[model samples]
Target: MRSLVLVGHGSHLNGDSAGAVYYYAELVRQQGIFAEVIEGYWKEEPSLRQVLKTSASTEVTVIPMFISEGYFTETVIPRELGLGHQGPVPEGGIARVIGGRTVRYTLPYGVHPKMQDVILARAREVLPDLDRPEVGRDTTLVVLGHGTTRNENSNKVIERNAAALRERGIFAEVHALYLDEDPKVGTWPERVGAKNVVIVPFFASEGWHTQETIPAELGLTGTATLFTDTPSGPQTVYYTKPVGTHPMIAEVILQLAAEASQARGGDLDRTHAESWRLLTRLAHGGLRVGEVLISPYSGLLELRHMLDEGRPTTDLLTYVTPEGLRDRVRQDDAGEYRPVRTFRTLPRGWRAVVDEADLRRALHYIYPAVVEETRAYTCHSLRATPWPTTARRQTGIYAKVQKASSAQVEAVAQKVCAACLRTRLWAAEPLGQTFFDGVPGGIPCAEACTYLVAAVRDELSAEKSPEKQDQAKLEQA
Candidate 1:
């Protein structure tokens, strides 16, 4: 079976860092090119170490969703994937045989030749006039990157991109600026020597750096193009969104994965046929996902939306495909979007009948990463992160959650997690066994999800509010 793994440097404090990775994973999955497509992270749930399941696929292609080849792409991913304590990685990436499986590691998409096109595409969006040679001749393009002292090559990747841009001759002057290293983002005025300047972040996603740091340093306003008075003269600066936001980047990542897959004798069509038996065999035992009961029926899996005991399936909606099932789960009864899939808000009255081959894939669409989560739980490889441990890592909006009392944690979990179908094995301390004891083969939650964190943060915020303090004062009076 041909399997593709998209790996990213996920941030615990901020969820937006790995946003692009998830976006592309879903995009690739919908294309139906690979039998299995999943995501791995360095700091978030479904981490790199635990993401790789013992699936039927002997060949797995891992593509780094990083802009540059740095400490993470080089040292971190290889170690976690058991690709050996390595030397230097090739530009195209390397293929290694580990424990009866072949792992193909591709270079990060940022350094690919196609990145020049992505950067230019983003630039064109900011400055439409750049298509004209005169505008290009007058413009200065700034490729902003986050440089690090730990790895000199992190900044070097951005520098090489700048050099390539200069050779392309679209922009009169192209400069590479870093947040950490020399030729920093703060020195844009002195560093750049053009009246028309365009700054584009070379990093992935609009995270803390792109949203908070870069704007503050560059003195950017709400408008896309702004004028600033400098020592040289009045300058017009056009700020484009980061390269990671560009949709064209999807093409680059897919091409890299395809090259590695095809080179290693991967058959996309037959991979599905080979993996169907093994993957479906895992789901042979009945399990409940959300309010749905999945059981084997006549060589096919039947997913029925659960009703009250002694109730019939008379009013339920019937679906024959995974897409229909996913659509049903994406919204509530009121038609509002439910980002958390396993919540009690799963729209009821829907049934789906799919073959063994489509069962795992269909379940994945309705409940993201449940197949791997179940496998991890089954093998006892699941690392259940405690709620407090996860709360402590949040140094942003959810930081106050770390100070929550035991009772507060329990109240929040009962309100939020009790409504979720996923068994909170990680939250067993505050919420006892009786909380999720009745759930049937419940989805195993490894860590505190983003929704739970938001809920805890809200409760904590309300606890310390001045309104609550005033109410306490009135009671005392």
Candidate 2:
């Protein structure tokens, strides 16, 4: 027997979050496609873990009822179900093993092509006269979704759907706006210029956003139609129900499950699995420089995996930033600092040394007479040695140095060594011996010594100059 599980992000405050999940699950049940159809929620009754165990069928297909392939669909759902190492799951994909059961996981409901039909249907219900030539020209279709700054990918589905809707020419124009991102709901009146506008919430359910936040933003008094004066003229705004609440959405879910079951026989793509494995490996041991951890965020792991497969990665460095590493550090519960195994060699002017002293100087130089110790540091070395004593005493720096140019790093190294020599902290003769002997193995020490010797040669040249001899004679006179 085969089982179907419809997973939804249920809300504790309202039952509406999981309302559509139950609606579609029942529809699938009545169709007799599987022996069992169960609805599960992250926050409501019949949790995913409980329902998976309760189902008697060895085969199951799990469909995520989300509008976008964002954090929840990619990371949270898979982790909770113990599927694919609890990471991002490919859209409309299969996970061959989950507690020894064959499982097919479909993409979120929002990105499916049929979702445009649901959107159009929602608009039609509000204004049955949309097909009328006069109404169609004056009317505009607006798709409202939750846009997040944290993950730009969340907006892709919404934007793509809006484009598709415009091509169909059901309305005069189509617009998409987000609650969390730019072109906010507050500016909808000014941005969407039409006498008759149909606004449809792209959310999965009619929760706080659709029922309260959206209505208040649009200044509606709980009525379906509201008249407001816009730049164009007097506009009639018709607010429709959420797309997920539409009963026709069940057909889309069924289609997704059927496709997943037939296309790959409930087996995850081998390439995707390999990519996940590489991500895990990099997370455990990869060269972390500056704000780049090369773990999962910033698409570094994906870039590496693609390169390994001989695929081109044009935008590998797009997501690499200092903030990405800070976020990862905050998430580390065990306080275990993973060693970096591979340093990403960037183009010219992107290389810098990661050292405790250099970072302290850089920070202090950037700030106004402030000297604060950092907890972690990252550096490149020719050979591995025991962790630095200073690092062990302090919190430790877990980042490699990044600069605008390699020349800048070399200049800093020379300046640092010269300062140490003048302060009597570094012995010139011993440092010179160490440099020539090459016993103390590490790129940092070798490179510093090279510049130190150059400084010495320049000093010797100045002492033997004729100008210096004349100055000595004048002082004697």
Candidate 3:
């Protein structure tokens, strides 16, 4: 059997990075397409060297889940794997191929042609009816992704996809956005110049960039579909989920793995079989903790699986940083040099000590009744007008609601007004006492106070749309 290895730019702090890798790998396995599939991460446990060793087979293929093919894929990965680029290695050389298996590496996931399918799928999902003759001609589509400051290729990927979609006549207009660099996300509304804007993330998965940064910047307050009241008083703003987890992504992974294996002179079909077994083993956490902490994203999943399998609770510290979180030990076994960003993890831990008290004190300013009132005002803003599609689409009433939504665009305003309030409460529940430290008036509290209000609003709107429609019909009749 051949083998395929899926490599990701993993994060020690965030579980989502690894989660994306595992999600795609599992998708490949479920199709019964590969003989063996294994995953190795840069930050988490089971270093690349270790995974490459354990996954040794006659022919091995490595697929990088990175969005761009510049630095990491071209330089770092090859340097680490000892696959020399300058020339064919003599018998004894620094860059040597081992495992008696031909090694092949494929293109990064973002560069895949099939990615266009996801962009289309997201547009269709958000604007299913928008494509009708009446809606299709008037709508403007924004294929937004997190462009990078470090890499030019990242922005190109989004731009290429948007251009391809426009060439196909899918949307009246299409544009790209970035978290950093020029033509930033903040300026997208003006650039598109359309009446309705649908923002679709060109990201691999839903993490901070997709979940927090993008929405916060756009002033989005609902689900994947962000809408505002129109000047005539109708709803507008559609935000789609990150394109990574869609069912179609599994096919892309398999296709890339096969391509990589073929480049190394291996049987693509057999390579998959080898990959399956390896992936299953990795899922079982076969590798030990070693000296470093694995990714909190996949490592957390693996840890949970290990716990389920009766593995001892090793002295693990899940590191939290702005970059992401990690399931780690104190020793620097990871051989990683990037600095970790700080974040909160569990009950009364580092985040609790640092931000919990402050958070609780803030919650008092956000008592349940106060939060509920804020939701009322914000929800009113949502239903108050038709969403503006572009900079020109802004009208008197729509502008009024947009301004109102922007004003209350905080945890308190959003939670009270949208459905995510419940989840926001749960996510923030751990820090309750900390926030209540010096509060008076009998420890005032509420059920929802911490999630991005706009996201929760969208979730609630989607869930209740059908019911809402029926109510509207009844009133009209």
Total residue pair clashes for candidate 3: 54
Give lDDT for model 1: 0.73
TM-score of each: 0.67, 0.53, 0.53
In candidate 1, what are the lDDT values of residues 1-477, reduced to their tens digit? 678888987754554555688788878887887777777777654566555653346678899898887767877788777788455578667888864567899888888888888989888888899979999888899998898887777787788889999998998899988887787887888866677888888978887788888888778884364556776677788888889878887788789987777655443333333334445654467655556667676778878766632345566677887767766666678877665667777676677789865676576656666556555565565678777777775654568889988788879888888777777787663222221123553668788776677778888888689998898899999
| Candidate whose TM-score is highest | 1
TM-score of candidate 3 on Cα atoms, chains taken together = 0.53
Positional deviation of 135 in candidate 3, in angstroms? 2.3
Which parts of model 1 are misplaced by more than 4 Å?
A: 11-17, 30-32, 54-56, 262-292, 295-357, 365-477
Displacement of the residue 355 alpha carbon in candidate 1, Å:
5.7
RMSD of each: 7.0, 21.7, 22.4
Off by over 4 Å in 3: 86-96, 224-235, 263-477
Who wins the lDDT comparison? 1
Which stretch of 10 consecutive residues in model 2 shows the poorest summed lDDT? 368-377
Global lDDT of each candidate: 0.73, 0.56, 0.50
Candidate 2 lDDT over residue span 152-172, tens digit each: 767888899999999988789
lDDT of 3: 0.50
